[model samples]
Target: MSTYVIGDIQGCRDALLRLLERCRFDPAADRLICAGDLVARGPDSLGTLRFVHGLGTAATAVLGNHDLHLLALAQGFGRARDGLDTVVAADDAETLLEWLSTRPLALHHAATDTLIVHAGVAPQWTVAQTLALAGEAQAVFADRERRRAFLPRMYGDAPARWRDDLTGDDRLRCIVNVLTRARYCSAQGDFEFAEKGSPGAQAGDLMPWFEVPERRSAGTRIVFGHWSTLGRIHWPQANVWGLDTGCVWGGALSALRLEDLHLLEVPCAG
Candidate 1:
């Protein structure tokens, strides 16, 4: 049985199917792990969601920022952007919303020491600490009443530092931002969502979360997908793999075989 970690699908179901076929994926025998952004910006959001959802126990996904945005819009917490034109506006949006809400912000595989998160981690957190913090934030979203109130407050940059005293929505927002939207962060661990371009294009003061010297997950193989601009980056010492190759922007869809570290990529149809 093989486990494959795929890059951001971004609703390019055909490209995803081709990559899976090239890998000879058997749903019954193989497991698939998606780095997230399973929908939006491409041709088939609904089909992509259905395909992944159909995988059932064979699949695991970390919630991407796009996925969270879809959830928020479905729940009426925010408006959809013009770029999100491909998302399904159907009655089943509620079902999609529920499934997306249940996804965890991060996943850890003890056997392989592989940690999968949507974006980057807070420089201050160890892998274990990040997992624990993710659980706390996930619990709030899991509860119906709390999630309704929490979604509105989910859109900010308050409580910049991790403080034990931060209560209510402030704390949850920080956790959500770190797990979902993070890319570059200040030395003090403050996230800057505005820097979406390639890593070198950013100001010298900002650093990629994984570049931090004391990153606790340095020993583990960390797989993430949000920064398509980074394309595929391999840090030998860090054991970090970035698979986002900008398929939504007509680039390539990529996947890595976890057991052997083999790469499989397919071009987008446009």
Candidate 2:
């Protein structure tokens, strides 16, 4: 059975199907992992959710920033019209949201020695620490009462540096931002949440999260999306594969066949 890691679907069901076809994916014998941002900025958010969710145990998804936004919207937290209304208004909205909410922020594939996250990790964190901290934050998101209380307080870019002494909302927020929205970050473990650009475009000491010198997680293979401009099939230094090709932005939807590191993509109408 082959495992395929796909980039952000962002509601592009047709693109996703075509890409899957290109990979010759068979739900009965293949596994799928989504790099997240499963909804928003594209058509058919509801349809895409059903398609992936219908895959059942054959598919796994991490929570992306947009995915979290959909959860917050479900709790009557925000009023942003970011193309997710179809999902919120669906009859199965609650069920779909429940499934999405409980997914991990970071997952490790022991067979591949690959770490899967929506975005990237804090430079100071090792593979074990990334998973542990992700679990700490995941606990809050997976529980109903804690999620209701934390959703509104979740929109922040504070305390970029990860400290062991950090606690409460601050600690969870740091973990979420790093896992779901981080890109350029300092070697000191500080993140530039505001900068959404390609590597050469960012200024100052900020570098791509994986490129940070002596990044503890650097030794393990990391599969991530969220940086569409980074494009398909490129490993930052050698151990990471960035698959987002901006399917929601009129680019191709890409996926990596993890067993052999083969890349496949399908152009999207956007």
Candidate 3:
């Protein structure tokens, strides 16, 4: 069986299907690992969620910022964004949100040494450490009472760096931001959320998360999305593959075959 790691679907159901066709994905024999943003800002958020959720064990996804937003909105903790009302209004909204809540912030496959996260990992974290930290955030999400209390506090860019001493909301926020929304950050591991352009677009000293010189997880193979402008990156030296191709922005839905590093893509209609 082959594993195909897909970029952010962001509600582009048609593109996802076409890309899967390109890969000849057979649910019976193939597995899909999504780099999050599974729903939002595209043609069919409800349909996308239903399809992905229906995949069950055959598909797994990391939680993207958009996915988390859906969870928060579902809990009445935030305003409804475009393309999300359909989800919140759906009959299966609760079930879908519950599935999303339980989804991991990071997924690591030891055999392929492939780590899938919605965005980037903290410079100070190893793959195992990253998963462990993710579990902390996941725990809050898994518990109904904790999740209700935590969702509102989830929207911020503060404490831009990771510290082992961090506790409570601050620690979980740091972990969530790094795993779901991080892109360029300082060598000191400060997240720069404002700069969303391509790699060279950032100012001095702000490098893509993986390029941080002292990044401890640099040795791990990370399959990530969330930086659409960065497009598809294959840097064997850095052991990072950036898969977001802006499918929601009228670019292409992209996927990478984990076994052979082959890429398959389908143009998006936006």
| lDDT for 229 (candidate 1) | 89
Q: Listing every candidate in turn, what is its Cα RMSD in Å to the true structure after a full C-alpha superposition?
A: 1.9, 1.2, 1.2
The number of the candidate with the highest lDDT is 3
lDDT of 2 by residue, 1-270 (tens): 999999999999989998888899999999999998999988878889999999999998989999999999999998867678778889999999999999999999888899999999888899999999999988999999999999999998998888989999999999999999999888787898999977888989888888888988888999999998873357757488888888889988989888888888899962
Give me the displacement of residue 154 in model 1, in angstroms: 0.5
Which digits, one per residue and each the tens of the lDDT, describe model 1 over residues 72-158? 676677877634534547667666667777888889976677888988888778889889888987787777787888887788777
lDDT of each: 0.81, 0.90, 0.91
C-alpha-based local distance difference test score of model 2 = 0.90
In model 1, the runs with Cα more than 4 Å from the true position are: 82-88
Q: How well does model 3 score by local distance difference test?
A: 0.91
Identify the runs in model 3 with alpha carbons over 4 angstroms from their true place: none
Which regions of candidate 2 deviate over 4 angstroms? 236-238
Indicate the TM-score of model 1.
0.93
Candidate 2 TM-score, C-alpha based: 0.97
Better of 2 and 3 by lDDT: 3
* Pairs that clash in candidate 2: none
